[model samples]
Target: MYDTILVPTDGSTVAEHAVDHAIDLAETYDATVHALYVVDTSAVDIGLGTEQVDRIRQGKFGDMPELEQRARDATGAVATKAADCGLDVTEAVVGGQPHGQIADYADDHDVDLIVMGSAGRSGVRRALLGSVAERTLRTTRRPVLVVDAETGTGSD
Candidate 1:
C-alpha cells in the first residue's frame, strides 16, 4: 500500500536489517525506496571539552569528513542493495538529529511509509535514553513499520 518508502540508516547491523526489510517492501509494492543516513550531532557533543569542540568545529579532528563520507557510503550501499533487488531507489545523507532529519525528509518528500529498526530498549533504559524510532513515530504523519532489532531475521 506504500508508494514511497523512506528508510533511514545509521550503519549499525540493526539499521542494515531495516534497510533490507524496506527494500523488500518497496519491491513488493512497486514503490520507490528513499534511503537516508543522518549524522547524529548529539554523538559528537558527548564528553567533549570546549577546546575539543572548537577543534571539531574547525575541522581539526579529521573525523567530520570521514563521518560524512561514511553516511554517504551507507546510503549508497542501501540504494545499491535495493536496486539489486529490482527496486527503484534513491539515497541522501543529512546532518543533525536522526529523528528530526528523518521526519523532515518524510514531510518534504511525500513519503507514504517509514521503515526503521528499533533497538528494542525498554523501561528504564528506554526512558533514560530515548530512541530515534520512538521520536519519529511520535512526530511523523506517515505510517511507520518498525523492525525489531532483536528478531535478527530482516535479511531473510
Candidate 2:
C-alpha cells in the first residue's frame, strides 16, 4: 500500500537502523524512498550537539555550505544504500527544527509512511534532550514506524 516512504536520518546508528527498516518496506511495496536530513538550526544556538555538526553550522553561510554538506552526507548515505538495492530514491537537506521539518516534508511530499529512530531516553535525559521521533509522532498525522535505539541495535 505504501507508495512513498520517508526516512529521516541524523547519521546516527539508530537512524541507520531505521534506514534498514525503510529499505525493507520500500522493497516490499516497490515504493520510492525519500531520505531526509535536517540541519536542526535550533541546535545552532546550543552548540549543535555533536562536534561535526557544530563545526558545520559555524561556517560562513546563514546555513553554511558545511552544514548542507553534512546534511547531504547523511541523506546521501541513505540514498546510496537504497539505490544500491534497486529502489527509487530521493534525497533532501533542510535547515529547521528537526521534528517540524520532518512533518512538513512528509506532508508536502504526500509520504505514505515515515520510518525513524528514537534514542528512547527517560527521566532527566528525555526531559532535557527530548525525542525528535516523539515530537514527530505528535505533530504528524501520517503513519510512523519508530525504531527504538534502546531496544534495537543502537546505543542510547
Candidate 3:
C-alpha cells in the first residue's frame, strides 16, 4: 500500500529499531525507503547556552563537528540497513524542529508512510516536553507508525 516510506532517525537505539522495522517493511512491500536524520535544533538550543549559540553563529564549534558527522553516519547506517534488505534507499540530514522537518519532508517528498520511534514518555512528562513522533503524528496527513522504544510495538 505504501510507495514511499519515510523513516526519521535520531541516532537513538529506539530509532535504530524503527529503521530495522522500516527496512523489513520496505522489502516486503517493494517500497522505496527514505531515511532522514534531523539534527534537532531545539535539543541543541536547550543543551547549549546562549554563549554556545553565539559561538555557533560565529562558526566556532569546530570541536563539535563530530556531532553533525554522527547524524550523517546514522543516516548512512539506516540506508545501508535498507539496502541490505534489498530495498531501494535514500538518506538525508536536515536541521530544524525535528517534527516540523520530518512532516515537511514527508509532504515535500510525497511520502506515503512515516515510521518513527517514541521514547515512550507520557502524561506530565510528555505534555511538558512533547515528543517529535507525537507531534508529527498529530500534524501529518499521511499514515504514521509510532514504535514504542521499550516494547518495539507499533500501530501497524
Winner by lDDT: 2
How far residue 98's Cα lies from its native spot in candidate 1, in Å, is 1.3
TM-scores, in order shown?
Answer: 0.83, 0.84, 0.85
Kindly list the per-residue Cα lDDT of model 3 for residues 24-65, writing each as its tens digit: 788888999998887666567777877765554433455578
Candidate 2 vs candidate 3: the lDDT winner is 2
Displacement of residue 125 (Cα, Å) in model 3 is: 1.1
Residue range 3-111, candidate 2, lDDT tens digits? 9999999888889889998999999999999998877766664644565454443332344567667777888999999999999999887666889989999999999
Question: Residue 97: error of model 3 in Å?
Answer: 0.5
For TM-score, the strongest prediction is: 3
Ranking by lDDT: 2, 3, 1
Q: Candidate 3 versus the native: TM-score?
A: 0.85
Q: Cα deviation of 154 in candidate 2 (Å)? A: 12
Error of 3 at 71 (Å): 0.7
| Candidate 3 ranges beyond 4 A from true positions | 45-64
Native-structure RMSD, model 1: 4.3
